[model samples]
Target: MLEPEHGLIRQVEHAHTKCWVCVLSCLLLASVYVGSLYVWRSSLPRDHPSVIKRRCASVLLVSALSPAAVKAWIHWADIRVDVSVWELMGVRLEGFVPALILPLLLTMVFYLGPLVHSAMDDPDGFTTELQSVLDVQSWRLCVRDVVWLRNQVVAPVTEELVFRGGMLPMLVPCAGPTAAIFVAPLFFGVAHLHHIIEQQRLQRDGMSVILLVAGMQFLYTTVFGAFTAFIFMRTGHIVGPVLCHSFCNSQGLPDIGFALQHRERTALLFSYLMGALLFLVLLFPLTDPFFYGAIPVCSLAPAPEPVC
Candidate 1:
């Protein structure tokens, strides 16, 4: 029904709008990436008197800027920011528990399965190994550390706010869910690569070791970034990924393939492998829109009609 010139004009406007969204998203991501490095490099030790204030200020700045950026993009794109913080950021109590539990359970099954299998294989060594692992002093030290609290809590919340909450939704309109999921996480993974610089500063490791470590970290974080992005898209909330990120930080990566020698250990490994496989198999159905009432059918566009 539109005239040729009118259609052409519309197309041009759409193209320009898309370009603006992409450019703004990139700028926001770049600022967060650079800002994170500056914060890390300039931050004092946890034991220092001014550490809390400095770190708090840095986090506050990023947190403020993230939502502001999101607002700007949504406005520029002529979209509505209708989702709540829980919906937008995924912080709902309903989803958060499962999000945290599943990953932790899987990690535990993978890492502790081998050790448990080893323990079962030799009852004599079980007590010693258990005692070594259960050392109250070590547990106490970890619990008491302020740095651990910051890493587990503050970092997860803020990083998710920036990467998943701010950058991802804006990207969905332009890139769609599939591309946005992986694309936003690429920046998230790259942000952590700064750790290699920190590592280099503190340790006298050769370039090879540093590079290897950095590469591994980049790979895993990028993979995890995809996962968090998927979770964000599925739940339509930021909390899901935030809690998951914190849990992942606390648990670290599982060391697999070490208990292959003994038959019992191998069996345990197989069990865990199967469990992980099952989780992967069910992940989609479990996260499907029909399963959660809180997940609304909405699009990144400004349409009055919802897009499921």
Candidate 2:
């Protein structure tokens, strides 16, 4: 019944609003999610099939329990907004079509170089790749790959659900939409710090290098987390962020250096630059709530602001 607030106080109107409470809740949620992965003791490497599957189960359990944060908010915050926890987390059916397409398209725009390079580098050509994609058998192969499934499917769904979907609602109540977009992702980035332990255990690199790589990964995930959070708030739909997250996972990071050194460097560079430009230009318009329906995110905020 009691939601404690501690740490830096963030100003907000109303009899009581606790951004710090939401933040601490997020930290606890993220810690549990990350800590769950290590509960299954195994000498096997992180990538081992058994280890990966067990960790997957652990994370999923934590992810499933994450909605408790929202439930706690509903009870203690005495929230004024008219919204169900499901709608606040963007689980509703409305605006789904745009959610399913627009976010993914906008994300693809960010990786145009890699996409083109991947197609051109295909020895058998784009048609073969297209056919493979269309082939149900290839999909079966994909399903069989545990690591691929973890990355492209389970990770995206659970992560967006818990990190962006669950956390953002709590955050927006006190942080405001813009601040929520930036703040919620910090927990996401911190959750990834567990990777340092895995890499260090494997001794794949020196401690400094491992730390550096972990730092870079943290940066990447945090930035990507912010993007997903933005779209989630904008479209007021979790499906859009989930789709975008999965697509980004499949694409991985685009290698600007590789594009610069590619044999067809000119075209690749152009595509890369243009893709960045297009993504920036289309970011707001594509995610405009006008296309997605009413700003369901408003349901999460305590009071309507320009953000809603």
Candidate 3:
């Protein structure tokens, strides 16, 4: 085989250097983000409106400034992609609706049985639930409620912007789409560890219990992070991840045990299996980048994989 060109070898060396910087910058970003919540000297529980609002302010600022991470990336003289941070962060207008709709719809399909169960458990009855959907007062109350707004909108948007939008751009160019999906989420997972501090402060649980819960949370969030990262890579747009994040926050995790114990176990079990099967079956097809238009970020991939 012929020797590689000197310029090609030097370019590869520069890319390696940039990847190292990305790794460090991502860790620093996660540290500052998680650190922000504790900066307030509040004695109140995390769920307290005042505390929630302050933390919200802290995180949103971090997200708004997250583009700075890209500046760190381009510090390497000849290695950077010369793309805007917003576009690198998957903020393009192409494939807007499908990015908004299909991934969230796919997640809901995975939670079909649990969501139906949740709706069925609404004691106010279907009519009341329907009315509530159309109720301006209810909408206003949700808007006014800091916790509701944080959960349904602010957290999802900010977290996705930071973990997916901000972090993925740095990581994709370095690790490529497949590896970045798994790698970037570890920061997302570790950033969630701050929850243990709040729970411990409240004395709501013993040390062991808090640690155990935090560990489990880390696992779950990391797995979810990978899924959102996967969606981000495939669509190369932040909208899908944000919508899916918001829906998952609203639904919580699927209550597999509750479904197992329900009176309609037969039908519910069928749904549980079928929904999962369908989700797995459609995961690739529904998320095809061709359907969403050309994904700009796939340029960072080492090779053109199907999802990209």
Instruction: Give the best candidate by lDDT.
Output: 3
Which one wins by lDDT: 1 or 2?
A: 2
Ranked candidates (lDDT, high to low): 3, 2, 1
Best by TM-score: 3
Query: What's the count of clashing pairs in each model shown?
Result: 7, 0, 0
Note the Cα lDDT for every prediction shown: 0.66, 0.83, 0.84
lDDT of 1 by residue, 254-276 (tens): 54555565556667777667757
Error of 2 at 29 (Å): 1.0
Residue 114 error for model 1, in Å? Answer: 6.2
- Estimate the TM-score of every prediction: 0.75, 0.91, 0.92
Q: Which stretches of candidate 3 lie over 4 Å from their true place?
A: 1-12, 122-127
In the order shown, what is each candidate's alpha-carbon RMSD? 5.1, 4.5, 2.4
lDDT tens per residue, model 2, 167-283: 888788787888889999899998999888888888889999998998999999999999999899899899988888888887789988887878899998888889999999999
Instruction: Give the per-residue lDDT of model 3 (tens digit) for 58-91.
Output: 9999888887765666564234465566887888
Q: What is the lDDT, from 0 to 100, of the residue 224 in candidate 1?
A: 86
> Which lDDT value does model 1 have at 134?
78
